[model samples]
Target: MSKNIVIIGASRGIGKELVQLFANNEGNHIIALSRNVEAMSEFDHLKNVTYKAFDLSSSTVLEDLTQILSEIKSVDILINNAGKLVNKPFLELTKADIESCYQTNAIGVMLSTQVVVPKMLNKGGHIVNISTMGAFQGSVKFPGLSAYSTSKAGLVSFTELFAEEFKETKIKMNCLCLGAVQTEMLEEAFPGFQAPLSAKSMALYIHDFALNGHKYMNGKILPVSLSTP
Candidate 1:
């Protein structure tokens, strides 16, 4: 059966790919979100894709989303792919930087799920959070990533907790602890560095993961990294 899926942070990067991949399928319906909806309007040409302008940081904004979602009925998959990263030295980071990271990466995912999960109750579904490998292991003076790492770690923990809550249900939750992927955010952060994985590749992998991932994975962190051999 075709499923209803919503991907947060669908303007670009991994989120964008998820929208494209899922919406392309005749069986799935995709609702994509981001601040710059124009960037994703190209996707509107697809029959199953819907674009919305949204920022996960605002509680009031989510209140509005809840109402909109009620009309959509239910979603079979929820991909929390929206996130922010600040790669400065820990000492160089400011309060705002840390807060923004936590707000987007940690709080955003948690709240967004809260709004979407009820729809999946009777039917069961999958929730995949885009996290970072940095959370699993300490980095080498990469600086400024403390907030990003911490937020992802929190997300990882949340996945476990969420899965436990649904132990009686068919609903499943997991986190994709990504390594360096060739996305605009990566280029902006590293400048000259080359990422081993492309957004297209990551998207394809994630698409498959979302479909079959729930079968083998629940409340576990799946890491995708170029450094892993």
Candidate 2:
């Protein structure tokens, strides 16, 4: 059976690898969405994969996504992997920095889900939110990640709340707070730091989880990391 899978932030890093992993199955139709359409050209050869320009930070996120959602028959799985990282000192952060982080990492994800929820309403689906270990309670914190981590924390809350709200239905939601992964995004936040895992390795795990994790858990916030607490 072919499943309709949507992967946001599909231009590079873990999201890009995720598209590759899922598309490898051949039976899965992968919808790759991101603000950078040109960066997604690598997926052009995959017959089962499609790319679109999606800006989560835009004020019209809901409207834009609503239009996209209508063209799809149903979404079997949705991976909210988009994020914004502003590595400014707490005092130096500007309003734009804060807003962009929250909009892309948190609020935008919520509104995007609002548009896609209808597609999953009948047959049900899984929504996996990708967050950061910085947002995990009692975890070690970073000095310049106040805005980034706080915004991701909002996603942590959304996963739990959305799961509880839709418990009676077949829909399920969960959050994964990741540690350091070797990627462009990591370099922006932690320059010269070598993460224990690569984006391809992390995406491998997420690919499997998005398919089966819902059977065992809902509203669960699991930490996927090699970092110490």
Identify the candidate with maximal TM-score.
Answer: 2
lDDT of 1 by residue, 165-211 (tens): 88899899999888889999998888988888899999999999998
Q: Residues 1-229, candidate 2, lDDT per residue (tens digit)? A: 6799999999999999999999988999999999999999999999999899999999899999877766798999999999999999999999999999999999999999998888999999999999999999999997999999999999999999999899999999999999999999989777899999999999999999999999999999999999646
**Candidate that would win on lDDT:** 2
- On the 0 to 100 scale, the lDDT of residue 4 in model 1 is 93
Off by over 4 Å in 2: none
Q: Let me know the TM-score candidate 1 reaches against the reference structure.
A: 0.95
Q: What is the lDDT of every predicted structure here?
A: 0.86, 0.94
lDDT of 1: 0.86
RMSD of each: 1.5, 0.7
Model 1, poorest ten-residue lDDT window? 135-144
- TM-score of every candidate relative to the true structure: 0.95, 0.98
